[model samples]
Target chain A: MVPAPSPTPMGRPSPPVPARAGIGLRHPHVQRLLDERPKVAWLEAHSENYLAAGGPRIVALDAIRRDYPISFHSVGLSLGSAEGVDPAHLARLAMLYRRIEPTQISDHLSWSVSGGVYLNDLLPLPYTSEALDIVCRNVARTQDVLGRTILVENPSAYLSYAASHIPEAEFLAAVAQRTGCGILLDINNVYVSTHNLDGDALRYMRSLNPESVGEMHLAGHAVQHIANHQVLIDDHGSAVAAEVWHLYEQALEIIGPRPTLIEWDTRVPPLPTLLAEASRAEARLSEFRQTRIHCYAE
Target chain B: MLSDLQAALRTGLLGRDDAEARAAVANGDGLAPDARIEIYRNNVFQSLVGVLAAAYPTVANVLGEAAFRTVAAAFIKSRPPRQPQLSAYGGELPEFLAALGATRHPYLPDLARLEWARNECYFAADAAPLDLGLLGAVPPERTPLLRLSLHPAVRLLGSRHDLVAIWRERLGGGGRAQDAGGEGDHYILISRTGLEVQMTELSAGAFTLALGLKLGLTLGRAAHAATLSEPAFALEASLARLLSHSTFTSFVLSDPAEEVRS
Candidate 1:
């Protein structure tokens, strides 16, 4: 039997991701996706998870990469580090990028590596000008090595730095404006960080330079009590919360539509449950496109 | 200044909570600075412990959730991962468990070793097994001088306990472990063959041969080692079973002159 043609052919540069909703490609879903071929607009992969040279994940990713546009969402970039981005990590990422050719790549606007130890969590970064310089330097260095622009995502915060001079959105905007990178506006993080830090969610959303955003992420967060007040924890463990979904709709209005993603990492349910979340985001993106079309028609 | 603040925050989260970190953070939305740092502290520890749980679910199953979390938290504090790739993080866990809980739970460490080996084999590079049929090309007299290379994914784990049986039982393989105790020495040969990891218990003679070969012993010398352990060791049977599944990647014919003679 003749093999079916792949949407994105091998050996070509990665094709751009469409302005629709996709899902984070967790390990459990890789084989199911191959067998079922679910209709997600694209798949976003954690770059570190797939760096092994020869493994089941790598093999599946090669087959899956042929059929779907992939986005490389990395957690280890540590762009906010003052110690500089790890050169060895950068080289490994570069190797994977050359092989997979993902359409979009991203990391958080936070540091996780400290004193040469990977803490394995996205630790918050103070938005001081000094941090801004360090982040920009690290981001620019990353772009130079990877030979493509990377998107920096806003992090979910539990506390503010006494020294943070810039707002979260403006800090991300400046990172995009200065480094020639783009913002991967994570709406759930906006809700969690603002609600936790006493910032107005609407104002933070409006503060971003919408054109600088290349992609968007929506996920569920957990609310916990911290010293008599409610704090939202950005644990991608469940369905997108109603309030976060509303914030996502507001983001669609302000930033227009980008390649949105629904991430459910912690207690990742079955594939259909995740696909349903992605479809909801897809519906919002479709609605945004329709509204723009109507505006042009009027 | 940026590095200093980071160090303080690191100390607050991973190390004992420091007053400097609490002061460095801004108290907002009725949450104290220490409480904020606690939030991050919980995240860092919980996520890492979660990673260990995924890698060694059988270990967690054996220890139960609360006990495993305690052990995992202590392991995290002691030997935190230096690599960015979290997949490579918990390689030291088996040895760590042995050091901590050997007296209380003797079999737990060996069980962890088996799981860790299987994890490594899963990500190891794929290499096609050599066709030993090509042995026809070598002169019959020189067959004993041939040295073999095990596949990159091959790992031989020897324990006093029957880790394979315990692992099976814990993974819901049904029947209880009739001999899960440290009764006889058990050897496990683990290797990835074509996307699936194949693990089988090896006999004394077979394990000795594999270990000898892995330590660069020639075929004749390895057979000598195997026969030393088991008088009735069947070389041809074991060789056929191992070679059939691509256990060894390549073989080199060595000169008899290189052998150290008594």
Candidate 2:
């Protein structure tokens, strides 16, 4: 568990992920990618979904990893679990890491399990000092074990904790500061949380330690009407809303050019449609870069 | 506070009478306890139902979505997920169905077990088939005492009824429902090779032989076990059947001198 060098961009060549867009590699799209080797910067996979020993999922990942730089996005690590991260899940992830050698590793800043019972959904956590401390310790332990500074993404929430004290942005900053881990800012989550909770998404983005921000996630959401209350669900089953994409553009301004991933998990469109969504992000990044360069010259 | 906070959240989410979640005016939409509690309740049940569906698609198909949801709700209330990976969540559903007079799906448990085994085999590791090259190096006389090792993906199941046939019938694989009817016993050998699951009907003798080898029995002892289960069992034929199915990934020779590490 020797730590790989501090990933704080300490004069190392930024990893191989080109400052471009990539699509989340779902199981349905595996065969297409294997057949044609689609023209995306890299592919991202849900780590837990591919933990099989010798199945088609693993085989597909093996073949795709050779052609495209893969990022292992884990959902089951449960970094915020009060029970702490599951050890066997971590061991299985470590084994997969050794096998695939993904370019980046990431998990969400939410708890999916409690009291040894897994809820499977990324349940929201109460933002408080005690929870922040627990999350940072677990992130540090995970980084120490994985030998890499894993990226912790924000979770889309439906409700807020009554006993909470700290703000979500401050909590994320504190976790990053304490653990020396990086952030995978999911702009869709920020938009979903801010609009529903009535907070300033822009200021929330500004509060983060930009240096620690390594990657960005943009996904789709479904609006649910419960008693005339509009709660946006981060249901990755539709097109990326215009507002979230605008926030993604703003994120590019703050974080500069990081590896952006267009994630669509359920009701995934055809391979070409996903690639088209990723291309939109690519176009935005290039436009941002050109504008930044022209303004610098001026 | 840490553990208590978790317990309170679980209690609130599970909607148990012992919920420690303090009802506050600032919680839920418009801060209503029923609505707040309802949010968690919906999430818990919905998630548990989703896990059951993933683990038991055949059962879900058998019962359809509505009844499956009812059964899933009951299963969740009766037995929540104890493991982080939801793959292991529905272990008690089959037994639970057997006890509950309702639902009337008699073969649900065995069907659930079959789906669970399919998942297990799906995630099991890939291995090279038994390299007889090593066996070729072993001396001739001591080979009779060799004990074979079954692959991790190999599972032998014996039942008093045609469980696999019933499962196939539900899957519309052309198996008749009558095939599972009547009071006759059945044996099956399930294995995964080349990323696809393979299930073969096994005779009593073959099942005995597989069970023995799985338990580390030597060749002679495995044959004896098969004979005990089926008197007319032919030892050589059963051995050849297992080998042809590529069950043994490696073997331990009877004599230490003639042993070749596989």
Candidate 3:
């Protein structure tokens, strides 16, 4: 039998990840993160990356978590799966969350499993009462086991569900309200899905209840030309496009301030590149706050 | 609606039937349902394929990129991933290799196993070395009676063929050339010492003794098993190696009921 995990470190949880620009702590940058401890306000790590019971990487993360607030982002939760959440995966995640004591924990709003098979990739889910019910229960159960409310991230999508009753923002808002969880708003996903499906990205952004949003994500994507039709790919490899940055600025305008993470998962560039992207996000947040102060004074 | 809704979502992802597929697709312009589904299908295939490719780079090299992907897709489809972690995704590849009718190379399965072990050791837990001082304080009479504790990262593998040589050829300093004349049964001890994982060949007796110790055998019993396997085995030297390698993180007397466990 697995031993009960070490308890969450007692104390005030590290101050919530600042509502400033942070970076996703991917492996390529682990050493760099330790060595430089760049000026980024906080860092978020993929939960599965540190699932090992022990290792040098785990040790490094343990050390880094001491200095930087961490947000444990999960890709494998399969929150929208018809099958119940994978208990082993949940247990492992719970164990890691306990050990890390991250300021915030999050997973995607997508399903990765079907017919007893895991796709190992985030799959799209329909927006219906049934889908919403499955997602809400899973979210609540996940939060219960982890002993904390988690932020469910909206996924980048290429397809839509015909039987869906609610709009995407409403679906997410409903999940947040029903489950008492929060949202990790991935602005790139909204932009990508919006561009791919030809919808108003700003409208989707405006519809989300800002107070319920726990965090925000900013990432870069690629434009894939498929058979003369262009699809925006959430590749997270290249530089954040100007339009997404603009959308992020718009989100900052509406949402006020929340923890923002600059994600660069694939085609990861040098550490400086990620930090630069994060710095850009920080500047935007600073500008947004300054503008709010000016408008209020006026 | 909860479980059934989840089931419907799954059916749509698997792309099993068009009616379910149609229901899953978004009717919004610019993105057709088939196209959206295709995007997801590609993402799923690409991600899992990347996991397999990482786990079996040599296999991928041997089969070439396209062929490896073809085989990986089939293996994945036939044997769906049970574990959410991608590191745990390819445990069945060795068995799959054994049954894959089109493999030009017969030894690929063993190599895949070696790579899998490498990954396992890479991600296994860290452990401190057993305290030599504590073991030294043990009364000489009970020293041999003490049970040795292996690190959680320890793995002992005994293969029927010279898969060890094959692994070394692909990965070792000797370079990548198969030695048909070097074929023989082989044993191995794989462990992690920091971030890097390494594999070392072991004698049959040493391997058996280490395996026994790993299973929580007392030092005396494990040594006895080692001697039974090979009369000329050196227990002291092996213990010293394990101690130096930091493989034995802790030790205890075989009898847990006893108040004095040291």
Candidate 4:
């Protein structure tokens, strides 16, 4: 019974997010962003953060959106939910996108809702065709509602399922082919999931078609020893780890270059620290742009 | 099959035990399925609890970290967010506190209620304030039948505890707590402007009138209810004060169909 969202603010869409590094538009740095207005290429916001009906935060986002191109990195779409995506959540997202006219939008490859309960973490899915159908159905429905295709990111999974038969990248590539969505290709998540599941990270990347990639995410992860076994948690609380940074460089070499975002969600450091991390990503992206880069073959 | 697996996984993550969820998972390289499922359980709890902590910081402060975590863990396990928006996740916490016999502080539930109200008001829908000048032009006879629509971000909170003083003290404004033993019921009006949430204590009669209007009663009936609740309720002064606070959003014109609406 939800009403239709208004048409996209601009009859024609604004320019897409630039192929350069962008920093996360977090709450703590909102004031500094308004006052200082740094020269970052673009800004990415967690869509759920600005979903309020009316508030100063919403006002701030409106003002900031005027200054920079934005991409909404949504976590609540829950594309992998077994019961299907929540209609209300999808409708709300559609409204927000129409209002903001974000350059691009995306959600994780995992599920967070089951039996009407919303689990906060992005839990992994068994890479089977049945699950693939559910994901495609959800993604298609979302795209139909938004009137645009969205990219799906690889999630940092803590567990491996024996029922999972299809390889991770192959599963993603299949999703892209079936749903017309693109891959987000988080290098840190690639490292974290592969490390936790004892899979080959490079081999996983090799299965994905480089052309299917539309954007990239790089974030810091925490290494922890649980029950005498080491697992890398994609906490997004600190700087992009050295291993993740190296993985990001290799991804740039493979994927060519895309709108890369540096996400530091947890112990969010100062603005300069985040901007510095973004500058590192910017430097690498600039290097890729300067060269005769060929995407990695599947 | 995916639904059954996800259902079992839900039980695994939020249930008291993960036996069913562990059975659903495939065992690991150098790790058992139990340990793998346990990892997700830990992640789910950590993130969900973090959401609750942010929503109910004053409650956490009053209860201290360890006790608050215990209540939060129990509350979230039983009541995982119904919606994907974690911002709206912790609404049932005050009721949950009362149900748990979490009587560490007598005013804890009311304080938690006030906090939830503030949270809701902060993020509620935005609407422009009703123009008093326009309303004044209405004929006096027509005014009695006019129904007022309350602002989206306005909330009327009634408690036995002096929540404003307590909230201020806990927020480190250095306000002294008032003795509430014989103070009767407390009515608080909460509305937000910009990032600041303004809290003003209201009289019993004014609260009654505001509550009636919020519940869709016409102005005359709402005022009548207010005066009946408190025989000394002053309508003129209370109306002026509520108007100054921008409590009402607009006046809903009567529809013939909803005319019979109770």
Top TM-score prediction, candidate number: 1
After TM-score superposition, what is the CA distance of residue A110 in candidate 4 from its true location, in Å? 0.7
Q: Estimate, for each residue in A173-219, the C-alpha lDDT of model 1 and write its tens digit.
A: 88888988888889999888878878898898798888888888999
RMSD from true fold, candidate 2: 4.1
What TM value does the first chain of each candidate achieve?
0.95, 0.94, 0.95, 0.94
For lDDT, the strongest prediction is 1
Candidate 3, A167-274: lDDT as tens digits? 878899999889888898999999998887666888987888887898999989988887668999897888889998889888888877788898888888899988
* CAPRI quality of model 1: medium
**CA RMSD of each candidate after superposition:** 3.6, 4.1, 4.4, 4.1
Q: TM-score of every model? A: 0.94, 0.90, 0.90, 0.92
Arrange candidates by DockQ, descending.
Answer: 1, 4, 3, 2
The candidate, 1 or 4, that scores higher on TM-score is: 1
1 against 3, candidate with superior TM-score: 1
lDDT of 2 by residue, A1-298 (tens): 1123233223432246667898999888888899998799988898877776676778878788778877889988888877788888889888888877777889989887777776667767788788998898889889878888798999887667677788999899899888888888999999988876777999999999888888888899998877767778778889899999888888888778788899998788999999999999999999999999999999
Give residue B208's lDDT in candidate 2 (0 to 100). 93
Which regions of candidate 4 are displaced past 4 Å?
A: A1-7, A291-298, B139-145, B173-182, B252-262
Question: How many pairs in model 3 have backbone atoms within 3 A of each other, for residues 3 or more apart or on separate chains, i.e. clashes?
Answer: 5
Clashing pairs in 2: none
Model 4 chain A lDDT-worst window of ten: A1-10
Q: For residues B91-190, what per-residue lDDT tens digits would candidate 1 score against the true structure?
A: 9999898787455557888889999998888888778778767865888788789899999988999999988878877876244454346588998899
CA lDDT, candidate 4, residue A160: 66
Q: In candidate 1 chain B, what residue range of length 10 has the lowest lDDT sum?
A: B173-182
